[model samples]
Target: MFDVNARIGHWPYRPVGTVDDLLKNMDALGISCACVSSLDAIHFLNPQDGNDSLARAIAPHRDRLVPLAVVRPEFAGWQDDLTRCLESHGMRGVVLYPNYHLYDLDDPEATELGARCSEAQIPVFVQVGLEDARRQFGRTIVPDVSLESVGAFGREHPSLKLVALGLKFGQPDQLRQPLPKNFYFDTSNYERLGDLEFAVSHFGVDRILFGTCAPLFHPRANADKLRCADLTAEQREAIGQGNARALFGL
Candidate 1:
């Protein structure tokens, strides 16, 4: 299975550390690969240094760990950073942390970055927050990015493949009303027994990807969630790995 959302590096608030541990954990759970980003990139003012760290760390394990570059579009000359990530690091996609970067989705720079990614046909992952709201760091009180704003971004870039992370509150009815066809959701935030089944029945199985939210949250819990979900073998295969493979060409 390929995890669409996972991270490597030290998380200050928690004791989670090392990409080696993440690899071992994924192995134990039968997860063959993970699309990972730098946890350091999440908080850094300029994400390029963090991206460099991630590239160096994953250089030897490129087959198992795919690097997703974090780009804070609010910073000046951010487009060049994105270019370097694709050209130098061989990144498969880019993730945005609007809450951490202190920018709204409606900001002009955000749209420009989206357009650029769309033109390049690169996948875009937008994380509302890295940590749970109730247990967030005292220094940084991050808020969830609005689902409405996500819909707007998706509409603006109709062909771009967008994934919304850390979202726990949208019903299928509400999501389908505005979200475009290219928008997908990862399962890291899904904790309930019937959530996956409900989402599949209402919103299509192709739109869901298995995610563990590893190191911050247990990987086994999500693996078991997929293991026990009421889905056919084909559905299980799709959500567990097929969707991610198709979306990111894994």
Candidate 2:
């Protein structure tokens, strides 16, 4: 399973730790593989620094792990960073954190950036929340990415496979709406497992994948939650390993 969300952070501003520690836990929990990034890079500097950190860590362990390039279009020369990620890091996709990066989806630059990602045949993942920071760290906070805006962006960029992570406070009615065919979501910040089943039943299993914003949250709990759900074996496989495999061409 390629975990679309995981981080390498050990600085004062960072919350998580090394990638090896994550791999150890992944091994113990029976996760074969993941595509990881650095939360520090995402929250701190522009994408190149974060992408460099992730690229270095995953280089030796390419068989078990993959690198997803992090890019901040809000910064200068982001296009070069985007090019390097595809040409150098061998990134299958890139993820964004508009809330953490303090950018708006409605901006012309952000819209073009999404278009650039689509042209590169790279999927884009965005973090809707980061580990419920109020409970995890101190009194830090980040704004929620309105699902409404994301839906509109997906509609605008019809060819891009846009993914939303850490989706919280999702009502069942939201799942029933006709989302873009290219739009998908991951499972994290979940209050109940039944909603995932409802999402799959309404949107089809291909649109959902298993994910855990790990090190901040327990990977075992994340894996177990999907396993224990009231889903068929086919649905379970799709979320567990199949969809990510298909998404990243693993």
Error of 1 at 152 (Å): 0.6
Candidate lDDT values, in order: 0.86, 0.77
1-250: candidate 1 lDDT, tens digit per residue: 8899998877767688588888889889999999999888887879988998999998989999989999998999899999999999999899999888888877999999999998888899998646777887677678888777887888889989999876674533455474589989888886665988988987799989999888788889889989999899999999999999999765
Root mean square deviation (Cα) for candidate 1: 1.4
lDDT score for candidate 1 against the true structure: 0.86
Each prediction's TM-score versus the true structure: 0.96, 0.91
Worst 10 residues of 1 by lDDT: 169-178
For model 2, how does the per-residue alpha-carbon lDDT over 1-250 read when each residue is reduced to its tens digit?
5576676655454456478888898888778877777666766666588788778877888888767777787898988888898898887788888887888877887898889988987888877776565654455566677777788778889899888888874632454377788888887665564877777877788988777777677787778878778999988888888998888766
